[model samples]
Target chain A: MSADVELQKVSVSFGNFYAAKNVSVKIEKGEFFSFLGPSGCGKTTLLRAISGFAEPSDGKILIGGQDMAGIGPNKRPTSLIFQNLALFPLMSVADNIAFSLEVRGTGKVQRRNRADELLELVALSGQGNKKVHELSGGQKQRVAIARALAIEPAVLLLDEPLSALDLKLRQKMRTELREIQKRVGITFIYITHDQGEALTMSDRIAVMNEGELEQVGSGHNVYEAPHTPFVASFVGENNAFYGTVISTNGDMVRVSSQGKDFLAKAGDLKDGKKHTFQKRDKVIMFVRPESIFLKDQINQADNIFSAIFKTIEFEGNLKNIYLSIDGVQDVRCSISNAVETATLSTSESIELKFSSRDAVVLPVGPLAVD
Target chain B: MNYFFNKNGPLISTYLIISIGFWLIFLIIIPQLYMFDLSFRPNIPTLLRGGPDDVYTLVHYKHFLFGSETSGERYNYVDVRVFLDTILTAILITLINLCFCYPIAFYIAKVASAKTARLLIVSLIIPFWINELLRSFALRILFAGEGFINNVLIKMGVIDTGINFIAMDVALYTGLNYAYILLMIFPLYNAIETLDKNQLEAAEDLGSSMIRTHLRIVIPHAKAGIASGCTMVFMLTAGALATPVVLSSPNTFWFTQLIYQWFNMNDNWPRGAAYSVVLLTVSVVFVLLMMKIFKVKIGEIVR
Candidate 1:
């Protein structure tokens, strides 16, 4: 019952400001796609556009090869689970689940039977007679899913459905939601500002910022090989060092900053290729915290550095060692608590090392700073 | 020794209890008890001559229950015909008000622009602050035989004669009863205004048509409002005397008007009190029944 969703150059403008600006993305059939961004970044606007609540100012929305320009929200083969769930408080759990069928003139007995089946699907089988207010937060979340699934719409649009739950419940629900999507096999378009939720549950994610689509790719690609600086900082923790490219070789680029020089793997750029960078062009080098290792335990490679250990935070599974490197200020190194030794302390001199391949060179943009 | 020092709590509570409790007893409970006592007294010698020597009898209650015979004429004491007429007319008026008020309340709450909504609500309140008597008199002038309505109808060639609009039931229902209807509309509008707009859109998104959306989603959500409005209108209409008295003939006296007659013209205070007690009981019963049927708590429906 899944249908592909295609938004062709969609733009939603509210008077002067654009809530979603010229966004174009295609969500494949049976795939879970997420719109990830901070609050007021137009992720919800883009989702509403797909759900037919907000018609795009200049664009075409297509579902299953059918254009949805003049169609109203009710006419589309899409169901939206709102942020608050919006369950009918006065109705019974079964009745709330079967509301879509009830509205279509289905008989009471048949609707209740169908509601019972869907309730079991969400693992709340025997609670059909309960009122919505009687259900716990997680149960209410499941009921909302059952209600959205009652219509068996081609696509289900969820607007931050997990935002209201506590942190642990939110994490547990992520797995449940992904499993449900697989079982239902419908195209799910989820909107959230939480990076963890998107990265964990979505098959592919589209990161948005200030009403602009930054990147659309799989979870790994978004986290590891982010196309833009915004994605690199937003997806996970990274220590960014500002520098200028001094020379470029076959597969490595040498950059110098604060009288310290380092080499990073040039994944996309090549040597003597009249690359876009002039000599001494400003650049940014991004390296994951986990890639930095203690120099005493490391076989030093191309990007080794020395720093002073300002503080050590023991986080049970890992030790977050904060450092002030020679050329980079306030750099953090995450080391796994792999050894059963004493914890590192503050005000200690330390050496850190990273291989050339572990560091990625990105063109320095205005978004280099946090 | 410290017992006296901790006496302030009871002292304050004692004064508060006396103030409010005594006020309630004097203002409400005492008068009601006095009325109840008077309702049991005799009616033959008339209550105008106040004395205990006049036999305390159930004759007035009997007269109210059955018809009375005076000399050679049979004068109905309770006036069942007028009583029935008053009740039926009151119910019909209340229903008509509900029909007229629902759409206006819905429009004001859900459809009107914010500025327009404010202006409309203000306009409704303006007529509300005007004295009911003055408003009823203005309506009387408008519905007079040769008033603006008949003149306009005649000038438009819709009618040849100036119609008798003032003493007609239509005038009572439409013009004189509008104030109560407006009162009913405000509460209904307030309730409907709190409904989530997204719920309506969600209904539509799920393939429910506009009529289905309103019937299944909007109206159910507005049930509390409907019950409150209907109850208020019914209660007010059932006990109303001003509109019917000023707008209708003597033959069209309402139940409240008859109750007034027993107390004033007829000097039958016992029967008047009896009729008032019955009216109050019926209004309370009806409100409770409506609350039960709608499955709404009385407190929720009221304020």
Candidate 2:
């Protein structure tokens, strides 16, 4: 049931503005792929292009080695669950589920039998006679999924199907969706802007920004080692420091900023390529907040800084500690509140330390870091 | 009870009761009761019959069903042919209007640009400003023998001689029928515009052909509008008197024209009232039947 998709440098433009510019990605068979980005980032546009709703201006889209240019949506063996569900309100639950079969001219008894089978598959048995409006939100979502799957298309596309649900239902539906994808073993191409949903449900996520594909990797890789600043800031929370590289060795580099020097691991930089810093060129270092520990508990590190506590916020599972350094703006550090009592107070001075491996030295550019 | 008689409550109740009572007495309840009472009375031997206390009898209804005799003259009563003609003509006009309006309404709702939609809507409404009689007369002048149409046709060498365009049913079909056609198209356009374009695309994506998509989705969704347009055209065309009088000959007299003849020309108000009551009854029944067949509420069908 799974089909591999290859988009080779595909670009879709509407007259003047580009929706997806030179985006290229290879999705493996049976992989749960998700396009994760903010709204208007062209994630849905790319999904629509793959579903043959919009033709690309340049480059080629291949589904299992078949060229997809000039193919109408109906001709392609792809099923898309729309954002609004689009269930036929006048039809019964069984009829909505059996729509694909009925359109294919299946007999009434056979269609009803198949609809009942799919209902049980979506855990919605005996719901065939119920009206669509009578179902709960979660049941309606499942009915949409069952309807899309009835055709047994090679690729199943979903466009923010859980966005309209409440928070608890959205979270619960995420698990159900992932489980269903696994059971069906089909290539599920999900599109959403929710970072948590993508990370939890996708086997591989393509993070997009401003109509461009930034990075595509597993959720762990995307969160742990982001290649671009946009990916780093978009995927999860991190602390960024502005600095300049002072020197470099085989695997370590020293960066200086505001009368302070810090050590970082050298990565992917060639000797002949133009480096952003030799002695005074500006650079930025990004470090995950959890990687920085309070100095008294630090046993191993290459960079350490002392700061005065400015504010402390008590979240349920974690406490957010805000600190102010002498030459830097306020930085936030998240500490797990495993115990009942608090450790630090406002205006108290504390030391924070991080290892060289955790600090990523990025080239300084115009893009701001959060 | 004291709260019910409070300032805001009694004020609102008084206004509501007075307004509703006025409409019920004058518009619907009183007029229907008067017509019912008038239908049962006998005509007096006078030049004009006025007021409701003259006589009580079933002679008017019996005369409507069977031929009747007055003091000095004999009159043919309402016949089955006239009733059938009214119903058949109403059905034909409704069907013709639907056929003409569907494509125009679909174009205005779906295909035309926003500016074009506004222009078409304005053009449809402009004819209403002219009096119906004046418009029908204007049509007569345009389609009569040696009128503008025949003159243009002859000058263009399409015909060697002038043709009597208004002497045929074509005049009734093209002239007065178009007003009801415009009315039908407006409601259809409103209903069709509410359809979701994405749903159509979804249907196509699900392997349904273009024709099937229209049949399964578009037409079913436009059911309410179709019912409303048909009802409006049928009711309006069936009861119309002026258009037929101007465009059609004496033999082409409509049912409403027959009712007018009994009342004014024949001076038999009771028989005319009975015919009017029957016309109203048949129109209401047909509208209700259509609403039932479409499985839509009457309110939904009209709007």
Per-residue accuracy of model 1 over A9-101 as CA lDDT, tens digit each: 999999999999989999999999999987898988888888889989988999998999988887788999999888877689998899899
Write the residue-wise lDDT of candidate 2 on B197-279 in tens digits.
77777787788887877777777888899999888888999898889888885467688988899889999877788888888
User: Model 1, which residues run further than 4 Å from truth?
Assistant: A250-252, A265-275, A325-328, A339-343, A364-370, B1-15, B43-65, B71-78, B104-116, B151-161, B249-251
The lDDT values for all models are 0.82, 0.83
- Model 2, residue B236: distance off in Å is 1.9
Which docking band does candidate 1 fall into? medium
Which tens-of-lDDT digit does each residue in A1-370 have in candidate 2? 6799899999999989999999989998888999998899898889899988899999999987899999988888789898988887767999888888888999999999989999999999999999999999999999999998888888999999999999999999999999999999989999998989999999999999989987788898777766666777788777777787889875567988656788976433322232344666677777787787777666889888878888878887887778887736567787777633266777888888989888777676434233
lDDT of 1 by residue, B54-111 (tens): 5566665556556665534355544666767766776777778877887888889888
Show model 2 residue runs off by greater than 4 Å: A266-277, A326-328, A339-341, A365-370, B1-16, B45-54, B69-79, B106-116, B141-165
Interface RMSD of each: 1.4, 1.1
